[model samples]
Target chain A: QGGVAIAECAACHGEDGIGKDVEIPNLAGQHEVYLYRQLQHFKSGKRSHKEMRFESRQLSDADMQALAHYYSQLPR
Target chain B: QGGVAIAECAACHGEDGIGKDVEIPNLAGQHEVYLYRQLQHFKSGKRSHKEMRFESRQLSDADMQALAHYYSQLPR
Candidate 1:
């Protein structure tokens, strides 16, 4: 499930979960709960990132959870 | 200047920039631009965290930059 969503994320976040740009956060080795919360914040407009908001809007709670887990386990 | 503001952050983030809780982020070695942007988001209410919003509101742009630089240099 996360692998599917990660396809989109790879554009900026990279396949290794390391962000392609300095302004983008590196998701590798991040706390799962923290990542999930940020995704929730983006979805709810509580964290404002134009692209992140749009991307997170496409995810369900489970998708977000899976994505967070997937990325959190990646090597930093 | 950043050292002064960091005293408050040390309570939760620790002197090493490691978060005390899973919900909080580990700031050590994070991208400076990313950290700065997050602080700006908190100050502007673009990223909504009750405590963070209040803390960031007290910081000037230069203060945020200093704090970002200070934390980003810490060992991960």
Candidate 2:
């Protein structure tokens, strides 16, 4: 919905946020605050994971906000 | 492989350890230590999430260890 294309995320989190089984997590239906919080955490290393941290690093605050909004709108 | 039925996990993490989508993280192909650490985190409140903490609370040390071992063995 924002500048970042959904395609990049879809590779892991699914074209929808219903990601691949187990290794990935479903982003759909999550609370926007929680999603934004985690993305911030991933970016800041408050939450530690190589891939997520790297992915989050690429996102701007606006991107995180928008993506969180995008995914939160999805059905679980 | 362990006494705990995979069915308990399959509800969310799949019959294997691959989680449903973005909200749930994949357990497959993850390191055993990482899995163990997260389970411990969830149980101990180092990580916070109602469902995960509740689920982890139901697991014993042995169960967490075994499940980590179990899920870690699955191919990504």
Candidate 3:
């Protein structure tokens, strides 16, 4: 579910979840709890990234978890 | 430079900066630039964690980089 939607995030975040730099942030190995919180933040506009907010707004709660799990398991 | 001081962080953060859980954050693969900014935030009391603020306040700029580098190279 998340894989299909999250495919677009990989271009900048990397297929393995190692993000580019300070501008982004490495998501690999991060706590699933934290990732979920951030996703919620994004969706609710608390995080306020123009792109990420828009993207997260489109995701269902289950999709957020799948994306969180995928990134959490990726190698940092 | 940072090794002698940061030894305290390893107990929970892991020798590799793979933090334990939602309570602690992983540092591996994180941006060096972001790490520096966070350290600065801790020092200035902006981040507001009792432990991190005290810890970062005691560090010199050079020590911050050394710690940042050490964590940056560790695997996620």
Candidate 4:
């Protein structure tokens, strides 16, 4: 469902779930609940950052959950 | 040299450079130069991401460089 969004995210984040670097932070193997919460934060302005807000603004609740699912399953 | 700064980072990113999850992105084994540039972007607002902006805003140029160096050396 969110494979498309994952693809876009992969452009910068990488196909394997690794981010660009330490500055970017890794998303693989994270808790699904945490991931969902962060995406929600980005979407609702609770997190309130410029880049994330733009990225988060584009996602639907379902999309965010899918992303959370995909990442949570990865190996830490 | 960057161990202290790295300590703060380890709170979220693992001591090994793996991030919290797939959404956060890993920093291990990334290009040093690329890492440096992104830190600069975060500090200068060129990247303009929210959570990153706040995080970057608190770092000194030296701190950023140190962080870049530490992550680039980790295994990807």
| Candidate maximizing lDDT | 1
Query: For model 1, how big is the CA root-mean-square deviation?
Result: 1.5
Q: For every model shown, what is its TM-score relative to the native structure?
A: 0.91, 0.56, 0.71, 0.56
> B41-64, model 1: which lDDT tens digit per residue?
889987778999999999999999
lDDT of 1 by residue, A1-76 (tens): 7777999988998888878899987788778899999899889987778999999999999999999998888876
Interface C-alpha root-mean-square deviation of candidate 1: 1.3
Q: What is residue A72's positional error in candidate 3, in angstroms?
A: 1.3
How high is the DockQ of candidate 1? 0.72
Q: In candidate 3, how many Å is residue B65 off?
A: 1.3
Candidate with maximal DockQ: 1
- Candidate 2 iRMSD in angstroms: 7.4
Off by over 4 Å in 1: none
**Model 4: per-residue lDDT, tens digit, B25-56?**
55666667767887777678765567777877
DockQ versus reference, model 4: 0.10
| lDDT computed for candidate 2 | 0.75
Comparing 1 with 4 on lDDT, the higher-scoring candidate is 1
Candidate ranking under DockQ, highest first, comes to: 1, 3, 4, 2
TM-score between candidate 3 and the true structure: 0.71
lDDT by residue (tens digit), candidate 2, B1-76: 5455357877888866656765665566555776788889889887777888888898888888888888778765
